[model samples]
Target chain A: MGRYFFHTRDGHREIDEVGLDLPDDRTAGLEAVRYGGSLLADDPHILRHDQGLRVECVDDAGKLLYTLLVTSVDAKENLATFATEKD
Target chain B: MFDRDMAPPGMAIFLAKLLSHSLLSTEDQAAIAALPHQTRRLEPNDYILREGDRSDICPVLRSGFAYRQKITEGGGREIVSIKIPGDPLDFQSMYLRTVDHNLQALTAVELTVIMISDFERLVQARPAIARAVMVDILIEASIGREWLLNNGRRNALARLAHLFCELHYRLLDTGSGGLDIHKMPLTQEQLADVLGLTPVHVNRTLKALERTGAIARDGRGIRIADLQSLIGTAEFSDLYLHRDQP
Candidate 1:
């Protein structure tokens, strides 16, 4: 199982419970969209009215991989505690 | 061409010269000179670029101030940096092929837009200009880092003073500091947004600075009573802005 950390508008997370990070090329492709777009430094397509970044993690190369999109980055501390308690 | 009334003539000419020396290659300038285009004038509230819109044009400020800022996830707005005349607006996205931030005019301004394709064509034809544009972007990133320092570490008063001193020197570089009172188009509310502070805090700080003889405020402008003293109070050094080099 591949491991990966995907950063979204909300926060970062580990994917697949496998702890194996994805390839750089794969990561960079995701990063290109997250950090604005491929051509622009910040995504101009993200309007001012849009909410903050909501990120999710993908575990594999499947068309619809098992991914979890976190809701709010402000809740990172709470999420960390929850993850720890679950573990 | 933008409306000429949008910017001071001297400031416009100065900006063009500075950009010509800094961001533009000789060939790029020649290409720009050869282009037959009209200039558009932008008022204080006009946006040069929005945060998430795709536009095929980027403007070079002939005069006045512009800044990049964003509303954070926490409902916070962080002003990334203050732009002076001659600064290349959105040059980063022009090359990196993406738009990262929103740029808005801080005063009535003039802009000369070069179509993105034409600009890229110029870059492809003149690879050296590409390198220069890259260097300019790196400088902007460095500036962004410094602003992080300012916001995270410095208090309200220090941040305000630092901004004034920084602008004073930057405008001086482009020969715009000769005016007795500089046009500081940003309202205290806007300044608070940029400095990551409340409007009340910004107002109190400005008043305190005025009372302490650090800065003199006259309507929309401010005059530094004592440059060295103001710098001391602000704990500011020009080293970070990197204006000394070309």
Candidate 2:
């Protein structure tokens, strides 16, 4: 069991001080994307790339796990960018 | 209709802007300026108009934020739209008897209300004003269609960014605070209701956007960090807003 904290931001700020237990960091990344999807689902209308939103995941030991970003440069593209220190 | 003194103070402040933008004549403006309206202040979270409440008055948001929302069948509240300064909250009530959504003050608000009967009476008398009002209504309809496009197609990041872009552009008339900052009174939970995202999800999206240097917020205000890139992500186009009407 691993503990992970996911900090979220839309057009504003929200910090996640409490961490949650997940199977692994991969699962954490997936969870964060799902979290983003839920946000997209809730608002009737939404975002832009510069105002685009994202998630940050950290381990219980305060180690940075990974950063997840959803970006779209063209109208036809929606890409997810994930940055992490380790495999 | 009201004379200058009889009109709600809130409505009076926005009259010139509305007249100039709608392209109505001075006499037409006089007609609206004469309305026997009422003004009131609401504490935050107070319900201004709820679903099923049929009111004959159309409210003008003089200051602060108001929200439009509907309740889902599953007993969840979904925010439909946010109203800022100079908006006519529940303008549709002129024709419809039952309100489709609830209007609430998201912050302490000053609302000036004009009775639909008086407004309609003026419209009946002045063909030009009526035409101008119709144009305004059409513009609002177009904005709604754009929102439909936002919800049905855009991804999460684009969805939030698009909203910021729209606000930045709209608030320009309100004397935008140094080109990028504006009052953002809605909490993440309220924003979540409007965005259809949970509070937790909104938190993550915000954190991600902050990390990417897209936006920043302090207290009840938000600033656009990167305009062009944010616009690119949302595929935002101001054409639908019709900000410039010849």
Candidate 3:
């Protein structure tokens, strides 16, 4: 098991500098994608850059974990995008 | 310490190096590293991959430093970020069809080439390792955000200070130097590209930082004469970095 940190923002104030002890980031990432899935339930494009949604995950030692980022609606890399496309 | 090679093979060594930045289990890391990989050494400014190249394998920096920069249509180069020892310079190319930026060696570099298919399989098999890589990518993304803030909001002097502070922590992560002094291998032009300033502006910024008693220039290195003062000048906080490991 490993500890993970969360940093989320939506064109406003950000949350960071704190970590939660978890099994790992992949587990945490699944939850993030799931949440993004829920947040973007209607449109698979809510997390798009035009929508200005970003979710970042990092490790305790200041190393980047990976991010759920969206540049456009068609971007298939975001958590919400993954969720919408999930089987 | 222990006899390096006598302990294990290439994968084991590679896994040990990754431990500094990841929390993957020995078995998982070893299993992934055991896959096919090619190791090579590169000189400074050597191109690991150029913009618009169609490459499949990813370059994992095993030693030294690297930088990712993009050349504009007008032939101006902009340094995006500096890669530490454990940084996978182009891991994203695993999915993206073509390269968008140029990745090059900033020092005598050591890179390990890992096939994308093999890595994907390894991650699919080892969920734990997958988590670690995700965490690493997230961390890099966060750094990008912080850099954006520096460029958009901070002045030239503060931008330079912030970059120096960020480099200090990154170098410390790589065990490159002591608590205060770091061996800065970057030249003025390279630094300017990262900061979106001219070389002359970078020089002036450095001198300004020195005047504030925040840093002392030591040849190609820098000594943080006053850590708190430097952080204050840069409005720098380690918060965005999310560092907790020693």
Candidate 4:
């Protein structure tokens, strides 16, 4: 098992000082996804502000392992523009 | 013939805990103090007992912290209870065949292990001691019910606040140097498991709590800045702890 840090950015950077021990990069990637999901669930407003949520998983030796990102787009605005162009 | 003054470090704490729960006679206290026991030290994450394990021994937390947890098949873990210094680790083993949950060290801990046969014999011989043990077990069950409500109903902020309040009161009851909130043992991940929240949510809720001036962060340690504010936030009630009993 190796130690993995899950640093997050959602309009602000939060560095994880105490990393979790996991088996490999694959597991770390899964953990990052779970962490990002939790962040999004806690506050979905960040996506509404056009700011993407990101979780960066790094190894103990300062190596970047994986990154999980979540973002949203205003599809309704795009649909409205498409309707106007068709007319 | 056991002398209270000559009792070992852990034995005194154990006796004090029982005495707080029930009115044990002098002979009963002496019997407990004289019980044959061994002291063991364990590091964090060490398993004291696992589900389905049958043991003839009972452990008492001499110092530091321990917790009981249940794990799901999907690798999810939920910490059901936190044990503090002087808390008996396995009273259930005396009557039950096997453990139902995992007991693990939450921090570096010292345990006083006694044979279940010996404990059972002493309880049978001393009605007061048996009553004390029963009260202790019932109190634990009461706390468990409150935890159910805390996890199932309370919001994230109230959930975390309620936990802090409970821990503070429990430590105070232990008479084990009270709680130094700055030196709180559980990590954020552990806290998440205890409160039924994720680490990200724990972090965010902590910041929200800090903004209320209920807690202050100094590097890795957190201190209780305004306990009244915290109590208000949690809507805490200590009736479940049963500190007033006996």
lDDT of 4 at B196: 82
The numbered model that scores best in lDDT is 4
For model 4, what fraction of the real interface contacts is kept?
Answer: 0.24
CA shift at B172, candidate 4, in angstroms? Answer: 0.4
Question: Which window of ten consecutive residues has the lowest lDDT sum in model 4 chain B?
Answer: B174-183
Q: Candidate 1's residue-wise lDDT over B7-93, tens digit each?
A: 344335533544533665444555545543347788886878887677677577777788888877886677777888767686666
Is candidate 1 or 4 superior in DockQ? 4
* lDDT of candidate 2 over B1-246, digit per residue (tens): 435445456766556336535766667767677678778899998999988897988888888888888887987897778777777786677778898888999999998888888888887899887776776677777877887888667766787788878877766654424226554566777767877665566665666666667787676566788888778877899988787863
When 1 and 2 are scored with TM-score, the better candidate is 2
**Chain A TM-scores, candidates in order:** 0.24, 0.67, 0.54, 0.83
Candidate 4 stretches with Cα past 4 Å from truth are A1-87, B1-6
Could you give candidate 3's per-residue lDDT for residues B150-239 as a string of tens digits? 877787777888887897887666455633755566777688789876443465467768989988877556678887898898888887
TM-score of 1: 0.64
lDDT of 2 by residue, A1-87 (tens): 797777765566567864566898898877777776665555534355465667778788877778777654543333222223232
Q: Deviation in angstroms for B191 in model 1? A: 0.7
Span of 10 residues, lowest total lDDT, candidate 2 chain B: B174-183
DockQ of 1: 0.01
DockQ of 2: 0.22
Candidate lDDT (C-alpha), each: 0.61, 0.72, 0.70, 0.86
Cα lDDT of model 1 by residue, A55-76, tens digit: 3444445333333232224368
Per-residue C-alpha lDDT of model 4 across residues A1-87, encoded as one tens digit per residue: 999888878778778876787899898889888877766655568666556888899999989988888888788998999999999
Best by DockQ: 4
State the DockQ, from 0 to 1, for candidate 4.
Answer: 0.26
